[model samples]
Target: MPRKLKVFRTAAGFYDAYVAAPSRKAALAAWGAERDLFARGAAEEVTDPALMEEPLAQPGTVIKRSRGSAAEQFAALPADRPKPKRVAKARTAKVEPAPPPEPAPKPSRDALDAAQDAIDVAERDWRKEQRELAARQAALDRERRDATERHEQALADLDRARRRAQEDYDAGLAA
Candidate 1:
C-alpha cells in the first residue's frame, strides 16, 4: 500500500505527497535524500485519504455544454424546407469625375534659415550638456574611489591597533 504524506512550506501552502515505500521511516529517508521531492517544504505522513482527493466540481462552477452535441434540439430546423428563389435585378453603376490636384506651397527663404538656425542651436546645446554631465560623473567617480580607499585604510588601522593591544597584554601576562 502507498503511503500519503502532507508537506507544508512557507512558499507552497500544503500538498499531499505519495510514497511507494512500506514504512514511514523508509519514506522519510527516501524523500529526504531525493532533492526533487518536497524541495522546499517540511513533510509528514497523513492518515486521511480525503486530503489527497480533489473535488470534481466546485459550487457555483459553470459547466459549458456544446449545442452541437444535442442533435435532437436542432432536428426541427427550417433547413428541411426549400429556400425561396431570388429574383435577379439589373444594377446601374455611375462614373465619377477625377478631382483637381492641389498645388504645393513653396517655403520662404527666411523660414528655411530660421529652421536651420534652430537645429544648429539645439545641437550645440546638447553637446555642451553632454560634456558637462561627463565632467560631473568623472568627479563623482573620483570622490567615490577616494572614499573607498579611506574606508579600507581605516579598517587596516583598527586591525593594527587591535593586534598591538593583544600582543602587549600577552607579554604582560607572560611576565
Candidate 2:
C-alpha cells in the first residue's frame, strides 16, 4: 500500500510553495529542493485544512502563492520620522547671462552631436538589456511548463506499471 499523503508548506522567495506528498523526502523531491528544508526549519507539515486544500487537490505539484502584497509589506516596515525641510535663501540680486547680441561663441554643434550620440548608445544598450531579460523570462516560463509536463508523464507511467503488475499478479494466482 502507498503511504498516506500529508500537506507540506515552505516559504520560498516572494512566494510560499506547498505540496502534498507521502513524506518530507517525497515533498523535497517534488519541490526540487536540494537541501532538506524541514530539517532547517524552513518548511513544516501543514495540518490546517483550509491551507491544505489546493496542495491536496494537486498532490506532488508545487503550488506557489504570493506571500503578501507590497502594501502589506510596506506597512510592516518601521516608520521613519520625516526630515526637517530646508528653505533656500532669497537672492538679493541675480546675475543675467550675456545678451544674445554678443553671440557668445555660438554653442559648438560638435559637442551637442557627441552628447546625442552617447545618449543613443545608452538607449540602445538599455533596449538590448531589456530584450535579454525578456528572453530569459520566456526561457524560465518554458522550463517551468516542461517540468510540470514531465511530472505528469511520470505519474502516468507509474500508474500504468502499477496496474499492469497488479493484473499480472491476479492472473498468475488464478492460473
Candidate 3:
C-alpha cells in the first residue's frame, strides 16, 4: 500500500520535509530528493486506517461555533492629555497698499521670426539625430549577423578536419 506523507515548515525558518517509505532510511533518502519537501517547512503522516473511515470536511465552507463566557468584564481606559494652546500675537507694523501691475510689452516681428527659425532648426537637428541612431543600429545588427555566420563556418570546418583525421587513422590501421 502507498504511504501518505505531509511536509510542513518549523518556527526556526527551516523546512521539515517528511516522506513515508518502507523504512526510515528509505524515507530519509526520498525526502532528500523531494524538491517540494526542501522548498516547504514540515510534514506529518496521517495514514491511520481509523481516521480514513471518517468523511473529509469541506474546506472554507464549514464553520465551527465556539463557547463564550456568560459574564464578561469591561474596563474604560483613560484618554491621552490634550496639547497646550498657543497665545495670539498683536500686530504693530502698518500694512502698505500694493501698486497696480504694469502691462507686458508685445513681441517684435523680428523676435517672432527668430523664434520660428529656432524651432525649425531644433526639429531638423532632432530628425538628423534619429537618422544617425538608425544607421548605427543597422550597422550593429549587420556585424552581429556576420559574426554568427563566421562562428558557424569555423565550427563546420573543425568538424570536417576531425572527420578527415579519423578517416586517415582508420586507413592506417587497415594497412
**Mind giving the per-residue lDDT tens digits that candidate 2 earns over 61-171?**
999988899888778778999999998766986868877785467667998899999999999999999999999999999999999999999999999999999999999
For every candidate in turn, the CA RMSD to the true structure comes to 31.3, 45.2, 31.4
Off by over 4 Å in 1: 1-107
Model 3: pairs clashing at backbone N, Cα or C within 3 Å: 6-43, 7-42, 7-43, 8-41, 8-42, 8-43, 9-41, 9-42, 16-41
lDDT of each: 0.56, 0.93, 0.54
Segments of candidate 3 deviating more than 4 angstroms? 1-107, 170-175
Candidate 3's TM-score reads 0.34
- Candidate 1 lDDT tens digits, 57-83: 221121223334346546736577678
Kindly indicate the candidate among 2 and 3 with the higher TM-score. 2
Model 2 vs. true fold: TM: 0.43
TM-score ranking from best candidate downward:
2, 1, 3
Off by over 4 Å in 2: 77-175
